[model samples]
Target: MQLILASKSPRRQELLTLMGVDFKVVLKDVDESYPQNLSPAEVAVFIAEKKARAFDEKIEENAIVLTADTIVCVDGLILGKPEGEEHAFEMLSLLSGRKHEVITGVALLQNQKIHSFYEISEVYFKSLEAADIRKYIEDCKPFDKAGAYGIQEWPGLVAIERINGSYTNVVGLPTHRVYQELQKLK
Candidate 1:
C-alpha cells in the first residue's frame, strides 16, 4: 500500500516531510468552485474531498491518499488567491485592521473510504497604510497566497497583531491536527 499526496502545494509537502511521512506527490486537478449556499468552511472541505476523489483510480488497495484545501474568510466572504498585483492590494487593504478566519480542510482516503476534517484559525491584523501595502507587494509580492498575504513572510511581522489558532494553518496546512489524525490510521 502506498501513501500518496494529491496536491502541488509546497507548504503541504514541507509539512508532510516534517512529519517524516514517506509519500509520493501526484498532482490532481479538481474543481474548486462550490455551491453558493456553502459557507467558507464547507467550501474548503468540499474542495478537499473533490481533490481526494481525483486519486480514487490510482490508489492501491489499502493505501492512504491525502488531499487538502485552504481558504481565508473575512466577514463571511472567501478571499482566494489574488489575480494580479492590483487584486493583491485590494485583498490586503480589506484585511487591514480586521479579524479574519483561515480554514483548511483535509481528506484522508484509506480502506476505500474517506475521512475528512477541518481547522479554523482567527487572525487579527493591524491597520495598514497604502505605503505598507505597496512595500509588501513589492517586497514579498505574496501573490501566490490567499488573502494576498503569507503569515510567515514580511507582512506577517508588520501587519498581524494576534492569532487565536494554529499558526501553521495560516501557512497552508494544519500540521498538529494532521499528525494526530494520521497516527490513528497507523
Candidate 2:
C-alpha cells in the first residue's frame, strides 16, 4: 500500500524517510481553527482529523493517508506558531526556566476509515538570557514553529534542559508511535 503524507513540514517528511517508509507528500490547505472549548490536545487532534478528512475522497483505495498537527501548551494556554519576531520573543520568554507540554495529534485514514491518536511530551527549558533569546530568534527565525521554537534547532540546543516523553514528538511527529500504528495496518 502506498503511504500519503498530508503535510508540508520538512521535519515530518524527514522523520518518515528515516523510518524507511516510502511515502508521497500531498499538500492541502487545512483550516486549523478550533472551538474555544477544546483543550490543547483536543485542538491538535481536531485539526489533524480535519486535514485527513480533506483527503478522504482523493486518496487511492490501496493508500493510507497520514495527517498531523503539533501544539505547545503552557499553563493551560496554547501557543501556536508565532506571528512575528516580537511574538516569538514573548513565547520564548514565557518558556524560560519552565516546563511545557508539546502535543502532536495524528490521524491515519485508510479505506474511508479514520484512526486518530495523540502524543504528549514534556519539555523543560533552562533559564534563558534575553541576549541568548534574541540571538536564537535572529539565527533560527522560528516564525513557523509552535511556541516560537523548534526543539531540534539552535534554541533547542541552547535552551532545552530535558524532555520526558518522545523526543520526536517535540520535533512535530511521534515517530515511535507512528511506526507502531502503521504496523497495525499491515
Candidate 3:
C-alpha cells in the first residue's frame, strides 16, 4: 500500500523516511483550531484527525493517509508556535527548570476509516539561563516550532535533562507507534 503523508513538516518527513517507509508528502491547508474544552491530548488528536479527514475524497483504496499534530503543554498552558521573538522567550522561560508534556497525535485514514491515537512524552528541562535562551533563539530561530522550540535542537542538547517517553514523539512524531500502526494496516 502506498502511504500519503499530509504534512509539510520536514521533521515528520525525515522520521518517516528513517523508518524505511516509502511515502509521499501531500499538502493541504488544514484549519488547526480545536475546541477549548478539550484536554491537550484531545486537542492534538482533534487536529490530526481533522487533517486526515481533509484527504477523504482524494485517496484511493490502495493508499493510506497519515496526519499528525504535535503540541507542547506546560503548567496548564498550551504553547503553540511562537509568533515572534518575545513569544518564544516567554515560552522558553515558562519551560525552564520544569517538566512538560510533549504530545503528538497521529491519525491514519483508508477507505474513510479513521484510526487515531496520541503519544505523550514527558520532557524535563534544566534551569535555562537568560543568556542561553537568547543565544539559542538568535541562532536557531525557532519561530516555526511548537512551544517555540525543537526537542532535537540546541535546547534539547543543553536544557533538557531527560525524557520519560518516546524521544521521537518529542521531536515531532512517535515513530515506533507509527510503524506499529502501519504494520497493523497490512
Candidate 4:
C-alpha cells in the first residue's frame, strides 16, 4: 500500500523517510484555526483533523493519507511559530528556565476511515541570557518553528536541560507512535 504525507514540513518528511516508509508528499492547504475553548492538545488534534479533511479527493481506496500538527504550550498559552525575529526572541526568553509541553497530533486517513492521536513531551530549559538568545537567534533561524526553537538546533544542544518523553516529538513528530500505527495497518 502507498502512503501520502499531507504536509509540507521537511522534518516530518525526513522522519518518515528515516523509518523506511514508502510515501509521497501531497500538499494540502487547510485553515489551521480551531475553537477558542479547546486546550492545547485538543487544538492540535482539531487542526490536524482539519488538514486531513482536505484529502478526500487525493486518497484512494487502498491509499493512506497522513496529517499532523505540532503545538508548544507553556503555562496555558499556545506558542506557534514566530511571526518575526523580535517575536522569536520574546518566545525564547519566556521559555528560558521553565518547563513546557510539546504536543503533536496525527491523523491517518483512508476511504471512510480516519485514525487520530496525539503525543505530549515535557521539555525543560535552563536560564538563558539576552546575549545568548541573541546569538542563538542569529545563528539559527527559528522563525519557522513552534516555540521559536527547534530541539535539533543549537539551542537544543545547549539550553535544553531535560526531556521526559519522546525527543522526536519536539522536533515535529512522535515517530515511535507513528511507526506502530503504520505497522498495525500493514
> What are the per-model numbers of colliding residue pairs?
0, 0, 0, 0
RMSD of each: 1.3, 0.7, 0.7, 1.0
Question: How do all models score by TM-score?
Answer: 0.95, 0.98, 0.98, 0.97
lDDT of each: 0.88, 0.94, 0.94, 0.90
Better of 3 and 4 by TM-score: 3
- Which digits, one per residue and each the tens of the lDDT, describe model 2 over residues 23-111? 99989997888999999999999999999999888878968999999999999999999999899999999999999999999999999
Q: What is the alpha-carbon lDDT for the whole of candidate 2?
A: 0.94
Off by over 4 Å in 3: none
Off by over 4 Å in 2: none
Worst 10 residues of 3 by lDDT: 55-64
Candidate 1 lDDT over 32-145, as tens digits, reads 888989989899999999888887777778888989888999999999999888999999899999999999999999876889999999999999999889888988878778
The residue pairs that clash in candidate 3, if any, are: none
Candidate 4 accuracy as TM-score: 0.97
Off by over 4 Å in 4: none
Pick the winner on TM-score between candidates 1 and 3.
3
Model 1 C-alpha lDDT versus the unseen true structure: 0.88
Please, what are the lDDT tens digits per residue for candidate 4 over residues 1-186?
A: 889998888999999999888999999678888899999999988998888889876677879888999999999999999998899999999999999999999988878577899999999999999999988888887888999999888778999999999999999989999999988876
